[model samples]
Target chain A: MIEFKAAAVTAPDSGVSILEPTTLTLTEERISIIGANGSGKSTLARLINGLVLPITGTVEVDGLDTVKQGAKVRRKVGYLFTDPTSQLIMPTAVEDVTLSLRRIIDDKSERTEAALTALEEIGLGGKGDVSVNALSGGQRQLLALAGVLAVTPEVIVADEPTTLLDLRWRAHVGALLRTLPLQVIEVTHDLDAASRAHRTIVIDSGAVAFDGDPAEAVKFYRDLMFGRPTRTADA
Target chain B: MISLLGIYRPGTTPLHKASAGLKSLMLLLTVIVTMMVDDPVTSVGIMCACLLLLVSTAPPAKATLRAMGIIMVVAVLTVSFQLWRGEVERAIDVAADLTAIAALALAISCSTPMESMLDLVSRMVRPFGRILPPETIGLMFALTLRAIPEAARIFIDARTAARARGLERDPRAVLIPGATRTVGFALQLGQALHARGIAEEAKPERTEKKPRRDRRSEKAAAKEHAAAQATADAETSETPLVTYSTTKPANDVAGPTTAPEGNTSAS
Candidate 1:
C-alpha cells in the first residue's frame, strides 16, 4: 500500500508545483493514472518508488517513509521506466537480469540460471544471452521487466511503460502487466488499459481531477482532453 | 564501443578453452617480456608470432581486417613520429611491442566471455570482501562493460540528432550534445544502481596495504596453487571439441563477450 500525505513536487528553478498538494492512498491490486503531458502523472507514479521526491509532505510505502527510509522503500518497490534502453544496463539480457539477483544469489552459476528462468518467464526464453543493444523495443522492455521481477519487489511503479511500444507489443505488455500477481501502479495514455484497472486516477493541471471508478476516471480524462460539449465553460 | 570492447566472438577454439586467470597472467608476462627486450629483431619475431596466434584463433577475415586496419593506422603514425624524433631503434622496438601487445589483447578479448572474466575477477577479490564486497566489485565490472556500448550508442544517437537538425559536420554541435547525453546516461545509471540498493551498505573502507597472508596460510595457498596448476595441465588440450560458426551473427548473439587469451576455462 502507498500513502501520500499532502505530498507535492515543486520545480526548483520555476517554483511551480509539478504535483499539487495531494493526499491519497493507493492500495488497489491495479491502479492506473491517466493524464496529459506534464500533468504530474509520472511524478505521482515516481513518488511511489522515491524516484520523484516530494518537496513537502510525506510519501510512504506500507510503513516505510520514502524520504527517510528510501532505500528500504525502494527495495520493496520496483520502478519501470518509459525506456528500457536506459534501465537494462547489463551488456546482455541474462546478464542484466542476473545483476538484480546478484545480491540474492551469491553463486555465479546459480544467479545465471535464475536469471535465465526469469527471462524465460518473461517470454524471452532463448534470448538470455542476447546483447541488450540488439533486442527489439518490445524485447528490451520485456528484459527490463524480467530484471525488475528478478528482485521480486512487492509493488511495481511503471511510468508510461508502453508509450514507446507498437500496437502489438503494447497489447502484449499490457496483458502481462495485468496478470502480474503483485500490485501495479501504472502511468499511461492508453485509455483501454486504464479502463481495465481496479481503480484509476485522472490528473489535470497537476492535481487529481477525478479518482475512484476506472470507467469514470477514463471518462473524465477523455472529457478533459476533448472537453465536454454538453456543458458551458461556467458549468 | 561494441566494435572494440566486449566484442567476444563465440568459438570453441583452443584459445577459448584457456582459463581467464591463466590467460591474464600470460598476457602480463608477454607485455613485461616485450617491454624489456632491447633488440629490434627479437621484438619483430615475437610480434609476428603474436600476430599469427591471433589470426589462427580470430573470427572471419573481413571483421578482423577492419579492426586491424584501424589499429594499423595508429601504429604507423606512432612509428613515423618516433622516426621523426631520430629514434629509429626506439621506433622499431615500440612499434613491434605495441603490435604484439595489441594483438595479444584482442586475442584474449575475442575468445573469453565477459561474465567469465567478471566472475574470475570477483572471486579473485573475494578475500577483500570486508573492505569492499565481491558483489560490488562484480557490479563495477558489469557497469564498465555496459557503459562502453551505451556511450557509443549515445554518441551515435546524438550525432544523428544533430544531422537531422542540419548540423552535419559540426563537431561542436555533435560533441556537446553527445557529451551531455553521455553524462546524463552516467548519472541515471548511478541513480538506478542506488535505487537497486547497491551502495553504502558496506561503507567502503579506505584503500590501504593488503592484509598479509600468514605463514601457515601461505603454505596452504602454495599447495592449493600446485594442485590447481596440475589439474589445469591435465585438462589442457589443443583439439577444438566444440564447433562454432566462423560467420558473425547480425545481432549480438548469445556467447561469451571477451575472455583473456589462451583457452583455459578456469574452475
Candidate 2:
C-alpha cells in the first residue's frame, strides 16, 4: 500500500507550488490519474516511486518512508517514464535488463539467462541482441517495461507510458499493463483508458478536484475542463 | 544512423573471443611496431594485413565503413600535409600507419561486447579501489558509452524539430533545446539509475574487520561518495522543472504543445 500524508511538492529553486498538500491512499490494483497538462497528476505518481520528493509531509510505500528509505522504496516500486529513450541506458535490450538484475544475480552467465527469460516473458525473446536505438517506438517502450519488470518490483508506476505510442501500440501496451499482476498506478490523459481503471483520481491546479469511481471521475474532469472558461478567464 | 564506438557486431571469430585486455595490448603493440618501422613498403604491407584481419571478423560492412569514415578523413589530411611538405615516403608511411591502427581498433571494438570492455576497465582500476570504487568507475564508463549515441540522436531530433519550423539556420533555436534536452536526459538517466538500485549497488560493501587504507585514500573515498550523493540530490531537486516545462500546455484548453523528445511514429 502507498500512502501520502498531506504530502506536497514545490519547486526547489523557485519555491512555486507544484502540488498542494493532499492525502491519498492508493490500494487499488489499477488506479488511473487523469488531469490536464501540469495538473500535478504526474507529481502524484512520481511521489509513489520517490522520484519527486514531497516538501511538506511524508510519502511511504509499504510503510517505508520515501525520503529516508528511498532506495528501499524504489526497490518495491518501479517507474516507467514517458520517453523510453531516456529510460533505456544500455546499448542492447538484453544488456539493459541485465543491468536491472545486476545486484540480484551475481553470476554473470546466470544473470544473462535470467535477463533473456525476462525479455521472453515480455515477448522480446529473440530481439535481446538488437540495439535499443534500432527498435521501433513501441518496441522500445516494451523494452523499457522489460527493464522495469526485471527488478521484480511489486508495483509499477507508469507516467503516460502510452502517450507517445501509436493507436495500435497504445492498445497493445495498454492491454499489457492491464494484464500485469502487479499493482499499476498510471497517470494518463486518455479518458477512455482512465475509465478502465478500477479507481480514477482527477487533479487540477495542483490539487485533487475529484476522486472516486472511474466513470464519475472522468465526468468530473471533463466538466471541469469545459466549465473553466466561464468560471475563471485567463487561467 | 552512423555507428560509433562500442558497437559490437556479433561474430564467431577468434577476435571476438579474445579478452579486451589482450586485444588492447595487441593494439598497443601494433602501434608501437608500426611506428618503429619507417619503411613505406612495410607499413603498407602491415596496413593491408590489418584490413584483411578486420574483414575476417565479418563485421557489418556498411556500418564499419561509416565509422571508419572519420578516420579516413584524418588519414587523408595527414598524408596531404606530408605530401605538401615534399616528403613522398613520409606521406605514404603516415597514411599506411593511420589505416593500420584504425582498422585494428575498429576490428576489436566491433567484435568485443561493451560489457567485457567495462569489466576490463573495472579490473584495470582495481589498484585504485581503495581511493575510488572500481564498480562506480566502470558504471561511469558504461554510461559514457551509452550517452554518445543518445546525445547524437538528441541533436539530430532537435535539428529536425528546428527544420520543421524553418529555423534550422538559427543556432539559438537548435542549440538551446538540444542542451536542455541533453540535461533532461541526464537527469532522467540519474533517476532511472537510482530507481533501479544500481547507484546503491555500485558501492562495494566494507567490513569493519578489514584493514583501512591510508588517510588520503579514506578521504578520497569519502569525497567520491559525497559527490555521488550531491548528484543524486541535484537530480531529484532539478527534476520538477523538467517535468513542469515539458508537460505544461501553451493554452489552458489545448494539450501540451509538444510531446517528449523521440516521439517517432511506429508505422
Candidate 3:
C-alpha cells in the first residue's frame, strides 16, 4: 500500500505551491492519473518513489517512509521517465540492463547472461549489443522498462511513458504497461489508456479532484478540459 | 552513430578476450617506448602494428577511421608545422609518435568493456577512499561517457532550432540555450541517478559494521590518508546535485525541486 499524508510540493525558486496539501491512500492494482498540462500529475507520481520529496507531510510505500528510507524504498519502486534517452544511460541495450543487476549479481559474465535473458523477455533478443542510441523510440521505451524490471521492483511508477511514441508504438507499449504484474501507477494524457486502469484519479490544480471509477474519473477530467475550456484556459 | 572513443566491437579475436588491465599496461609501455625511440621508421612500424591489431578485432575500420578523422587532421597539421620548421626527419618522427599512441589508445578502448574501465578506476582510487569516494567518481565517469554524446546531440539540436528561428549566426543564440540546456540535462541526469538509488552507494552505512583495515596498517593508512587529503583537496571540489528552481504558475508546474530542463524530445 502507498499512502500520502498531506504531502505538498513547492517550487524551489518561485516558492509557489505545486502540489497542494493532500492526503490519500492508494492500494489499487492499476491506477491511472489524468490531468492537463502543468496539472501536477507527474509530481504526484514521482512522490511515491522519493523522486520528488514533499516539503511537508510524508509518502510511504508499503510502510517504508520515502524520505527516510529513500534507497530501500527505491529498491522496490521502479520509475519510468517520459523521455527514454536520459533513462537509458548505458551505451548499449544489454549493458543498461546489466547495470541494474550489478547490485544483486556479482559475476560479470553471469550478469551479462541474465541481462540477455531480460532483453529476450522484452522481445529485444537480438539487440543485446545494439547501441541504445540506435533503438527506435518505442523500442527504447521497452528497453528502459526491461532495465527497470530487471531489478524486480514491487511498484512501477510510470510518468507518461508512451507520449513520445507513434500510434503503433503507443498501442504496443500500452499493452505492455497494462499486463505488468506489479502494481502500476501511470500518469498519462491518453484517455483510452487511462480508462483501462482499474481506478483513475483526476488531478486539478495540484489536488485530487476526483478518485474513483476509471470511467467516471475520465468523464470528470473530460468535463474539466473540454467541458469548461475557458475556466481551465489560464490554468 | 557511434563515438570514435567507444566503438567496442566484441569478437573472438585475441585482443577481445585479453584482459583490459594487461592491455592498458602494455599501451603505457608502448607510450614510454615511443618517447625514447629515435628512429621514425621504427615508430611508424609500431603504429601500423597497433592499427593492424585494432583491425584484427573486425571493427568497422572505415567508420572508426572516419570517426577519428579529426585526430588524423590534427596529426597532419602537427607534422606540417614540423616540416615548415625545416626538420623533415623530426616531422616524420612526430607524426609516427602521434599515430602510434593514438592507435594504441583506440585499440585498448575498442577491446575493453566500459565496466572493466570503471572497476579499474575504483580500484585505483581505493587508496584515496577516505577523501575521495570511489562510487561517486565511478558514477560521474559513467555519466560523463553518456553526457558527451548527449551534449553533442543537444548542441546540434540547439543549432538547428536557432537556424529555424533565423538566429543561426548569433553566438548568444546558440551558446546560451545550449549551455542552459546542458545544465538542465545534467540536473535531469542527476535526478535519474538519484531515483535509481546509485547515489546511495556512496553514503556511509549505519546498518552494518565494516571490517577494520588493520592495526598494523592503520597508522600507516591514516598517515597516507591524511597526507593525501591535502593533495586531493587541491584537485577536487563539490559538484552540486541540483539547484536553480523557478516555475510559472500552472497546474502542470513541476515541484520547485524539479529541474525545468527541457525533457521534451527534439523529434
Candidate 4:
C-alpha cells in the first residue's frame, strides 16, 4: 500500500534533482528497483523508510504520511544499507538484534532471550556473544538482517545488500531475503536478483524508464544501462 | 604503526598464570601504595619491585623499552625539574615514583589480556545496580581504548590526503574533515550499540525489579544469574576468538609518498 505521488527528491547541498517527478504504487509483495550508480535507485528505496524525504510531492506508507509520521513509518519500514559494517552498530551480534527489541521487551533477561531466539532463527545462534567486527562479510550481513528482522517491521527495504559479498554469500543473502514474509523492496544492480522479484522497475536520470514484469523490465534496464539503442520494448 | 590489544606471547611464566583479575587488583594496590608513600626509599623499593615483576613476565626487552620510553622521558623530566628547583633528594624521589608507576602500568599491558581486563572491570562494577550496566561500560571502555589508536591513524591519513591536495595550509583541511570523520565514527559506534540491544533505558528496569526480592535471595539470585550468564558466554566463546591481527602480510606493499608542500607565501 506504499505510494509515492509525484515524488521528486533532490540533494540538499547541490540542489541537484536525483529523482524526477514520478507517481507509483507498490502493492506487490516483492518489488526490485534496478539502476546504475547515481541512477537514484537507492534514493527511491530510502524514501520508503523515510531515510530520505522528497523535496516535492508526497510519500505515504500504508496511508501514513512519511514526512509527518517519519518515526512511525520507520518502525514499519526497516532498512538494510549496502554496508553491514556501517549498519551494524553493536559490538556483538546478539547485542545488535537485542537492540531492536528495546521498544518491545524492557526487561534485560527477556530482551536477551528474544535476541538469542532471533539469532538462532538466522543460523547464528552460536555467535550470539562474538564481536561483530570479527565476523566475515557474509555473517555480518546475516547478522544485520537478524537485527532488522527482530524489529518485526511490516516492510523491509534493502539497498544493494549483497554488493560486497562473494558469490556464495551473495546467493545466500539473496535467498534469505527472498524467504522473508514481509513486503520486500530491494535496490540492486544484480540482474539475477532483479529477475527473482515479482515486479521490476528501471530508473534512470531520477525517473522510471520501465515498469513491468521482471523479464521485460530487466531487458529494458540492460539496454538502458549499457547505452544500447532503444529497443521496441522500451518504446 | 599498528598494534593489537591482546595476542598471547609464548610464555609459561608465573605472571602469565596469575588470574587477570588478581593481577589487575595487585597492580591497583601497588599504584595506590606508591602514591601514599612519601619516603624516597619506599618509592625506590616499589620501582625495583615493579621492574622485577615486569622482568619475570619475560616480554621482549625491546618491546618493554619501546613501550616504556614515554614514562622514562617523564621520569627524567621530573628529575630535571626537581634538581632545577634545588631539591636533589626530592628529584630522586619523584624519578623513583614515576618509574614505579610506569613499571606497574607496563606489567598490566604485558600480562593481562584485554578481554579479561574488560571482564574484570565489569565484575568490579556489577554492584552499582543498573546506574551503569557493567558490561556496557566495559564495552565502551574497550571501544574507547581500541578507537584511540584508530582515530589517530585516520587523522594522519586525512591529513596526508589534504596535504596531497595542496590544502595543507588551510585550517579547514586538517580540522573540518577530521572532525567530520570522527563524528561519523561516533555515529557508527552509536549504531553498533543500537544493533547490540544495549540502550540507556534498559538499566532502570533492573533497579525497578530489585525491591521485590529479599536481600539474601537477591544476592543468591544475582550469583546464580552471573553463573548462568558465564556458562552461556563460555559456550559461545569456545571457539578461538578472532583477534584483529596487526601483522601485515607480504604481498600488499605500497611506496611512501611525501605530503605536498604548502604555500605560506599566499598571505
**Top model number, lDDT:** 2
- Give the lDDT ranking, best first: 2, 3, 1, 4
| Clash totals for all candidate models | 11, 0, 6, 10
List the candidate 3 regions with Cα displacement exceeding 4 Å: A229-235, B204-267
Q: How would the docking of model 4 be graded? A: incorrect
* Decreasing TM-score order of the candidates: 3, 2, 1, 4
**lDDT tens per residue, model 4, B75-183:** 8888898899999878878888788877766766666555456567777789994687877777676667656655776688789989999998887888888888888
- Distance from true position, residue A173, model 1, in Å? 1.7
Please estimate how well model 2 matches the true structure, expressed as its whole-model Cα lDDT: 0.83
DockQ of 3: 0.26
Tell me the tens digit of each residue's lDDT in model 1 across A1-235.
8999888888989989898888999899999999999898988988888777888778889988877777778789998888887787766787778878866787878988999999989999998756677789999899989988998999998888899999999999999999999999999999999999999998888888888889878777788888674222110
For candidate 1, the docking band is: incorrect
| lDDT tens digits by residue: candidate 1, B12-109 | 77788898888788789999999899889999998998887787676546656677787788889999999999999888988888889888878887
Residue B264 lDDT in model 1? 27
Please name the candidate that would achieve the greatest DockQ relative to the true structure.
Answer: 3
Model 4 chain B weakest lDDT span, ten residues long: B204-213
- Model 3, B124: alpha-carbon shift in Å? 1.5
> What DockQ does each prediction reach against the true complex?
0.12, 0.21, 0.26, 0.05
Q: Check candidate 4 and list the clashing pairs.
A: A89-B191, A89-B192, A89-B193, A90-B192, A95-B196, A95-B197, A96-B195, A96-B196, A98-B197, A99-B197
Please give, for residues B152-264, the per-residue lDDT of candidate 2 as tens digits.
Answer: 87899999999999998898888999999989889988987876667585543322232323455445545555565556767777543333323422222322234335642
Best by TM-score: 3
lDDT of 4 at B43: 85
Q: What lDDT would candidate 1 get against the real structure? A: 0.79
DockQ of 2: 0.21
The collision pairs in model 2 are none
